[model samples]
Target: MKNLRVLDLTSCVDLLVTPKFSGCKNLAILILERCSQLVEVDHSIGDLKCLISLNLKFCTELSMLPVEMGHLTALKELLMDGTKVEEIPISIGQFKQLEGPIATLPDSVGELIRLNHLSVRDCHRIRKLPNSIGNIGISLVELDVSGTGVSKFPNSIKYLQKLKVLRMDSCFFKEFPPDIGELTSLEEIHASWCRSLEGGIPSEIGKLHNLRILRLRHSTISSIPMEIHQLSNLQTLDLLHCDMIKELPRLPSSIRELHVDDELKSSEIWILDNLRLQRLSTSKLPAMIKLSNLQTRRLLHCNTIKEVPKLPSGMMDLRVGDELKSSKIWNLHDLRLELLSTFIIQEEIQLSDPDLVDYFAAP
Candidate 1:
């Protein structure tokens, strides 16, 4: 039919193959999602020049797409989230309106100037992104490359004036482009668990006035950029398991939740005019004594104290890790203990490994 605007074959579990679309020149939307048995798509799909949206999600048996699909210049959105497709066709760059993804992307991906959102998460085989990716700077908003082996980011990323969210979790990038501060519109940047990234946060990062959440937990960076104090909208700062960092920097006034290593368990809490800092994990009890609104405190692997130090007056819950074995001095505080939310006690927690469990129980 010449006027076909939409063809929804969703949940066609037995559909083994799709018909050629050579005659449907005006077809705008074609959805074959959840077609469990679909093994292939006809190459004549390129004939549908008016096709704007094509969704082939969860088609496990389908692993490849006909290269002729690239001829659909009017294609705007392509969804292949749960498919077996290993690599994106190089010709796909012709679809300037393409938006998102799953396993792999082609170098031609940089040609999609209109792409707004791209997610190549858990695609371990993709070692690096093409320098051409910088071409999407004009309209690209969100880009996620978590769980890959990408070693570097394009210097052109700074050109993405409209970009907002960027997630690079569990990757091994050596260092971020220093001029990253040029992206003035960035909001949330989650690059946690990137243990191999060497350099600390770029000073330009503080220029992101709209940035709210910055999660760099479990990374190898040793120091925070002094410029971080300029993030006027930053709310959550996570630096957990950052063992190389020697000192914690004072944060912006807007910070509400602060997550760091056990090293800062005793540092002073910022007593600002608008103190939104709430929960913290520290080893020293002195940090907890000053904050009036501090709610939750975790004592992680703190082993030295003979007696539990005084906690914040308004503190609600306290979580104690696998440490503090003293059952004798647990009565250091004589105040109303029943009023606390979760009273932390000294005890040894069981490990997951069989040998480690027996080792902890020995003697």
Candidate 2:
């Protein structure tokens, strides 16, 4: 009876603890996803030497892993995405095949060269990544240190040649490494909201030919290097709340989504023309009615918005600050408006149009 190969008990809401799987010698996959009440796993599960994937996502009650979890020699993928787990067993580094977060990444992490995806979101204690992390460059596909205390990255970071996604939002990284473009496989770089991060972006950013999305929103980035226009594949660029950036350079036509502050001059806004723009957010809406493909428009609060430009008739979503006084100047009765309450400005709005009411709060 020890031949169980796959065990899926996903969404077992009432289950508080994992049963022993020690006897399942051939077990390959064990999925306990969305088991909201699951608090802990029996350490004996470590005996499943052939186990490959263990998914425990959405187990909010789970705060710790069994100390013996590192013994799963053959386990490859371990997902605990939404759990409250604060720390992982460092012996996990001995897993050799382990992948992916918290206070401090053990230096032994270098031992798991099979590690691919690692995320340490909101771990305030970790000051830096283990220099040994560079050992898994060939297999590390994504690395995120968003909302952490990491003030600097190890020099070994330049070795992540195969990495695709690198997000360091709200971290302590004072100055971004200039050699980030060395990660030639990178497709997205989200480093927004780091108040301490103040500096001109490196021109080497242009070297990331594969980059597709770049967000430096609510940050102190002084200005976007002209080299940013070199990102031929970049489709989204967010610089909202960056008070230092006076105006954006002429962007590549590949841009489909752009978010900027209200201070941008009207003259500098028109240069983003006839591209693949699908959505745009700014203080004063741009006159890009020709972006027929544009579906979403978010206008920030601008006290001087005298008139609303003719927006796309096919627009699916329209978000404007409650302070927008030119409501009567725009024609929005025909479009389907979908706006979330969170994006709605905390103010009153007096609108008789039922269509607009769905997206705007009444005064």
For residues 47-86, could you state the per-residue lDDT of candidate 2 as single tens digits? 9889889988888798889988888888777776777776
Where model 2 places Cα greater than 4 Å from the true spot, the runs are 4-20, 28-43, 53-67, 76-87, 94-101, 283-363
- Worst 10-residue lDDT window, candidate 1: 332-341
Specify the highest-TM-score model's number. Answer: 1
The superposed Cα distance between candidate 1 and the true structure at residue 217, in angstroms, equals: 2.6
Q: Which run of 10 residues does model 2 get worst, by summed lDDT?
A: 340-349
| Candidate 1 per-residue lDDT over residues 164-267, each given as its tens digit | 99889999987765877998998999988988878687888878999999888888876778788889999888888888777655577787667765565535
